[model samples]
Target chain A: MNTVIDTILAHRSVRNFEDRALTREQIETIVRSAQAASTSSFVQAYSIIGVTDQKKKEQLAEVAFNQDYVVNNGHLFVFCADLYRHEIIGEMESVDVLPSIESTEKFMVATIDAALAAQNASIAAESMGLGICYIGGIRNDLTKVSEILGTPNRVIPLFGLVVGYPAKINDKKPRIPLEHIYHENEYNSEHESNVQELQSYNEVVQKYYLERTNGKRSDTWTSQIAKMLEKQSRMYMKGFVEEKGMNKR
Target chain B: MNTVIDTILAHRSVRNFEDRALTREQIETIVRSAQAASTSSFVQAYSIIGVTDQKKKEQLAEVAFNQDYVVNNGHLFVFCADLYRHEIIGEMESVDVLPSIESTEKFMVATIDAALAAQNASIAAESMGLGICYIGGIRNDLTKVSEILGTPNRVIPLFGLVVGYPAKINDKKPRIPLEHIYHENEYNSEHESNVQELQSYNEVVQKYYLERTNGKRSDTWTSQIAKMLEKQSRMYMKGFVEEKGMNKR
Candidate 1:
């Protein structure tokens, strides 16, 4: 209904971008908006790494499974769940904070903080007429990504936000029906109704894929999810996170 | 620079809300904007439970340690990291998907998805002249919160988003300096430089609190963070998440 709502609704991941880097002002504005997001208990437990070096971008692109867009975007921002600063605060104040920092609750706070900031950054960039895509592929090899970025312990790079001028805008993908995703007062656990709703949603997704690919690809949402989930990917994530000195509790 | 960015930059948690519930249209619009957020690999692994029942709100307020805003807001939305629907999809398609669904990777994906959507909802509500606050306090007792919400397995309530008209607007909390939070090309790991920046930031924060509380409170940011982190809170989150069939790999 308003400019902000319209901007949020029009969001779509842009993988193809025009060959132009963003201005310093644009990047600052976006990051500033990101900083304005709510932090849990005033604990701003996140950081952003702006990858501008061509060599570093190339390395990140490799870590992201050779996604050229990772390097070719106007700018790449690695959103990291960082508690290292809190560790520093602990040292400065002479407090033993490791017990709480290593707890899973803090990990959730940092992760959520990073995600909320990244979303604000995405919306800010989109408002400036830039297209953004979140590169979750960076997690495919967290160790390598962390090494390349020189991130210290307790700082896990969760994802990358690629912002650039879009070469082409794709049609919006349909989301789950509001009724299916939104529960009133309590969660709707009616199995039969849920299954029926999902079945109808499957048809809608199938049609979208068929139309998008000119009938070359038509798969139901359930089938796609099932197939993807059948293959266990990134099984080492738990160990990796723990090894990074987080979520050890 | 624009309306969207302006709305995001002006964000502040609104706890004192006007005693008026949101219209159905406002809730639908906000939820619609939330759904438009980017999901990883099209796996929409999250759900929103909007609590409207008075009794349910009171129970949630209790779970949130008697934060009356939990019950007094225009709307209370519990953003959940949900994978139960994916499990149901596996059952429908006769595929074993538990291995991947329980992986730390999927857990991160679901949690990020929920946070991104919640941020969008918050911005959308704010854009419409409403106030929003993220209720991380609901996380204090997640099991009881889940029971009250009637959530099934594989659905962990991450946090709540309270939206309403504001009865009072407090001064915005100052964030970390952009330089402190944003690193260039690589992580800025110089301990001395970081400590210096943080020391400077502590002054700004101390001044804000001092002014806001009429000199009654003047604590440095580092001291506040250190004090908060020194206390062990929510030690059962990891086990709770594992018991709920997530991040168990």
Candidate 2:
């Protein structure tokens, strides 16, 4: 209805970017907007790493399965769920806060904080006529990713946000209908009805793929998800998070 | 720099809201903006429960430690990390997907998806001259909250977002300095320098609190967080998430 909502609704991940670098002023504005997001309990348990070094970007691109945008974007921002600063606060205050810091609750807070901030940054960049893509592929190998970033304990790199001028913009993918995703008063647990809704949505998604790929592909959303989930990926995430001294409780 | 960035930077939680309900159009726009956020691998592993029933809102308020805003807002949206739909997809496709759904990586993806969507919703609400607050207090009693929302297995309620016209607007809280929260190329892990930066930030926060409370309170950010973390809260979150059939790996 308005420009802000328009900006939000127009969001599409841009994988290909123009050969242009973002000015420092743009980065500052984006990061400042990120900082303004509502943090859980005001903990602000997140940090952003601006990857400008080409060598470091190359390493991150490798970690992200060689997504060229990871290296070629106007900027690369690695959002980290960080409690290391909180740990430092505990030491300075002489508070035995390790138990709570190690709790899953804190972990959730940090993760949520990072996501909220990154989304804000994304919106801010988009509003400035930039395109952004969230690179979750970095999680393919968190250990190597962390080593590349030189992140400390209690700091987990969640994902990368690559922002730049878009070389191409794809059609927005259809989402599950609002009725299927939004419940009123209480959750609607009618499994049969939900399955029916998905069945219909599956057709819509299939049509989308068919058109997008010129009838070469027609996979339904359900089939895609089921195929993806048939085998476990990132099974070591639990151990890695624990090793980072988070979510240990 | 633009209106969108301006709207994002001006955000502050509004606890005391006008006693007015959101229009259907407003809620739709908000949720649509939410759905526009990036989802990991298009999993879209989240649901939003809109609690408009008075009795349910009252129970949620109780679960949120008697935070009346839970019931008094323009609307309440309980964001859930939902894998139930994916599980249903698996059943329909006759594909075993439980192993991946139960992984910690999937849990993180769901949680991050929910947070990203919620933040978008929050910003959309704010841009429309409304105010929003994220009620992590809902985590105070997850089982009870789930019971109230009638959430099924693999559908964990992460937090609540209350949006409404504001009755009061609090001053925007200061964030950690950009230098501290923003690193260049790699994570700046210089503990001593980081601690010094925080110490400087602590004074700013203390001054803010002192002014806001009319000299009645003057707690530093570090002291506040340290005190909160000194006593573990929501210690059951891990068990609760596990019981919900998530993060098992």
Give one digit per residue, the lDDT tens place, for model 2 in B1-249. Answer: 889999999999999999999999999999988999999999999999999999999999998889999999999999999999999989999999998999999999999999999999999999999999999999999999999989999999999999999999999999998888999988889988998999999999999999999999989999999988998899999999999999889
Instruction: Write the residue-wise lDDT of candidate 1 on A140-205 in tens digits.
Output: 999999889999999999999999999989889999999899999889877888899899999999
TM-scores for all predictions: 0.99, 0.99
Task: Give TM-scores of chain A for all candidates.
Answer: 0.98, 0.99
- TM-score of candidate 1 versus the correct structure, residues matched by position: 0.99
DockQ, every prediction: 0.89, 0.90
User: How does each model score on lDDT?
Assistant: 0.94, 0.94
Q: Note each model's CA RMSD in angstroms.
A: 0.8, 0.8
> Candidate 2's residue-wise lDDT over A96-189, tens digit each?
9899989999999999999999999999999999999999999999999899989999999999999999999988899999888889988987
* lDDT tens per residue, model 1, B145-176: 98999999899999999999999997899999
Q: DockQ score of candidate 1?
A: 0.89
